[model samples]
Target: MSMHMEQTVQPPVDHSVSYPKFLWRALRAATDGGPLFYGSMTILTIVALLGANAWAKQVVHGMAVTDMTDHVSWGLYVANFTFLVGLAAGGVMMVIPAYLYRDDDMHDVVIVGELLAVAAIIMAMLSIVVDMGRPDRLWHLIPGIGRMHWPISMLTWDVIVLNGYLLLNLHVCGYLIYTRWLGRTPNPSWYVPFVFMSIFWAFSIHTVTAFLYCGLGGRPFWNSALLAPRFLASAFVTGPAFIVITLKALRARSAFQIPEGAIERLLSIVRITALINLFMAASEVFVEFYTGGSHTASARYLYFGLHGHEELVPWIWTALGLNAAAAVVLLSKPLYRRPGVLVAALVMTFVGVWIEKGMGLIVPAFIPSTLHEIVPYVPSATEWIVTAGIWAFGMMIYIVALKIGLQAMSGRLVRSDLPPAVGAVPQEAE
Candidate 1:
């Protein structure tokens, strides 16, 4: 007999699972963490709960509970909102290198940046909601349900861009993670276009936020043409600085070895952007002091006391000091190379940007009210609590998302029905 008999062909493995199953697996991965993870989550949850209680009290009582007054209407919440918007926008820095430049190392961790954007945007939205006092009125911003006043109101534009950017990031991250969980290669056509669009969208969110402030002719301090550029520059600095710290943490704590090259690239970005941010700030200061007009009142009050009032004087100086110190350390190759020094520099950069964008920028604008009367605004304890809570909540979201992402990227969170993916492992940097 011709032994060429019947050849039995093995069928290709399906390796596919239901979307619900994929989600379940992702949840399991996110929940599976060490003691440190659990402890951190618990602390964040406690803080978030405290914040929620504070907000509940605020809702029951009114905006009067906070320190806000008619003269200084916008306070801590709006300030946080402004800073977080820039932070969200900053995520595009990672995406630019990963997708646009085709950087493999960056590509591997770009999802972290995108996920950070999602968390930041969520916090930013919460900041706005809390600032509104009557959170229920948020429905008014909806286009169909309420009057969005599109094309007319910069606030409407802001709502659109922020929500759009949030959705874009969510889609990109969700699609990538879900597809990977299924042990399938993500289709470039599905997410590539959105990733590129997000770059421009990120810019728009911050630019529009800047416009929202600068568009106010009444607020001379915010009416600067340079505000948008300054926002972008500072965003780049804070965004990459944050990523560097996160990458370092991942390398230290997690199985996923984040590439040193990626951290170096981010450090380089921070060095350049930090310098640019400082230059822009200096330019603004020079222009404000040189002009010596009524508009300079806010700037003067911010940098130096505009009379007997010097509440913000200390705040602005501290922010400047921090920014200056961070830039110095980041620029110093010796310091930047040391892991501890790099993290400290990045933290300083983040905090410095926060103060610069928050208290330094927002409060000063309203220091001398429209009637030219000096009225200083300070955040109340409730405001502080709520702010802390929002931050904690954001951290919680970020940590969970990061866990899911890392697990998926490592090929550890694949379809349960299939064996561990063969040759599907990503080449992580050594």
Candidate 2:
């Protein structure tokens, strides 16, 4: 004899009826809730406040407070901004698996990445603000009201895509999560097409960011055809790894269960992406060193020492070492199975990509200036404080959003009155 079982599925749920209530409930759930949740938010808020204060100092004191110069104009702020944009785009990787691939577990857990994308986009914009000496003049970017530079400029296109992507994600996530909070399945027509668009928009964000950097003929290090590919590869690695770690944490803390095959699938994605990323890095390196020219100066400074300035050498190598270590661990099925090893590998992958993308990619490009001046750049105290604050602020957003996600997943915050279970009944009568 054989037996089959199934979950009670809701039939054609109309979620709008309870949606207005979900907003208040989710907001309340964010607050009048758990100790640990609020505790983390408190710490992140303080950090954000501290960062805001530091930015105020920059506004008053001037750009002299930072180590940036005409030669190396963009520093920690832009680097972080660039990195966060990649992080935001990477969120779509999760959505692809969940929606396109029809992975049921990933579909349920999709909100985690959506929350991450929102937080990251917010931080990326914040980074842009803090990096500018004239943040008050930001409205100039507005189409009709401000600077109005678009169609002709890469930066303008970048601004459009980044903001558009952010808003698109916000809508999709808000609609889906709100429906979930109302204890109803979302209308497929509402979010399904948007989900597909997000996948393409995600690629655009990273590709545009790479073009922004690589378009600079003045900086040969970033002026490579490989930049966009590398950006996508690294994003694939870090984004899925982040989701995996978050899933594990969620599994441990809440009643929300991550499906059995999810982690394994994520690990496989990381393995493949990491391999491509490393390959691209090696290819770029070989070309840079083998065909030596003024074009290779920035690469030289990054890999070895340029003249006497070897500052970035150690940082780049450290990033490389961590990436290699992470790839090795991830590639091994036996080691990847261990929880401790898995966590450590994911951390290594994220940290490695952070350094590689931020410091390694940005700082070195400006070292050997067009005038052949070697300017060794290091972040200022104000830069560090502000950078730390941006991350803290983003973390706060992610944590709160993730908390609400857990509630929705565990069916604690909202109880869906699903239809009763139905199955074929055994019959003896004809």
Candidate 3:
């Protein structure tokens, strides 16, 4: 018998109940009590405080406190931000699998991507703030304020799209869940705007983010049109890898059960994307190395090793190896279906892509600098801690979002006690 068939075969139990109690029970199931939730939240809060404190100190002292100099304009902050924006876009990919294809198996997991997108955008906004020399003056970007730059810059456009997209997601997701919460069917008209907006907005975030880097002509690596597409490819790979891991975690934790084929199907999608991602990376590498231009030296620095800065070389090679191994494992149907192999693929892709985006995105712009000098950067302890803290924050949000969604779907949380059918008995009354 198939896995889904086996799961659907149920033992006898009480079947009659009101929707409200069923929903309330689900809510209790989702939110009741757990050390994992409390512990993660507490750790995230402390780390966020530390990060905020570090940011304040840096602001007071000025940009001089950061490891970034004039030569290395973009560093860890921007790198993290870039990686996360791609991760957020990963949700759009989920839409393709769940909504477009009507893959019912992934229906429960789709909202997890939406929540992940929300948390990632938050972190991306934070990273940008932390990178700025005058983070306090951020109000200038707001409308009716100091200076509202128009079509002159993609950054301005990006700010608008990012925030707009974030709000749209919150509204759509909120409406869908709240309607369920209130024991009412959602209006079709309400979701129409969001469905359209989300599709366009997904392409916008990463495209504009790429424009920020590529618009700078002096940087050869960022100049290519391939950069934006590359960002999207990586986003699809990493975002789903994260979702897969979270699904596994949820399966381990609660009474909530993900049906059998769901995981293998998702893994199949991950494998396909990983292959595409690897192809894109390989193509970029070939274009850079074989062409042999001013940027070739810079590309070489990233791939093989540089004379003085050998730190990133080993890491990059390992990243390449890990990604290749992951792609191979995922491509094998038998291997990818196994839980152990599936988890390994997720880990490999996750770590590989992080390094690929982190070092790959940052280092290239610095090499063959406008000043024609090579500069090596190492993120300070403060930078590392802040990055970790921000990541922890995103994970915490995903966990909570999953909890609420699980309860809402499982008939445990109900907004009201209402009867689906009414029984009438004749009686004499005055």
lDDT of 3 by residue, 84-176 (tens): 898888877666656666677776556777777888888888888888888778999998875778678888988987898788777766666
lDDT of 1: 0.87
Give the top-scoring candidate (TM-score).
1
* Model 2 Cα lDDT, one tens digit per residue, 1-430: 0001132475654546566667777877667545666677788899999999998999999988999999998988998988899889878877888877878767667778888888999999999989887888988999889976678788898899989888888898787666555555566777778888889999998999999988888678898989999999998888888888888887776556667677777778898998888899999999999999889998989989989889888888988998999999988879877869988998998988999999999988888888989988999999999999999999888887876765655555664354321221111100
lDDT of 1 at 318: 85
Model 1, span 144-199: residue lDDT tens: 89988999989889999999999999999998888677766666778888988999
Report model 3's TM-score to 2 decimal places. Answer: 0.87
Per-model TM against the reference: 0.94, 0.91, 0.87
List residue ranges in candidate 3 displaced over 4 A.
1-31, 337-339, 416-430
Query: Which sequence of candidate numbers ranks them by TM-score, best first?
Result: 1, 2, 3
Best model per lDDT = 1
Candidate 3: 10-residue stretch with minimal lDDT: 421-430
Which segments of model 2 are wrong by more than 4 Å?
1-20, 415-430
In model 2, state the lDDT of residue 198: 88
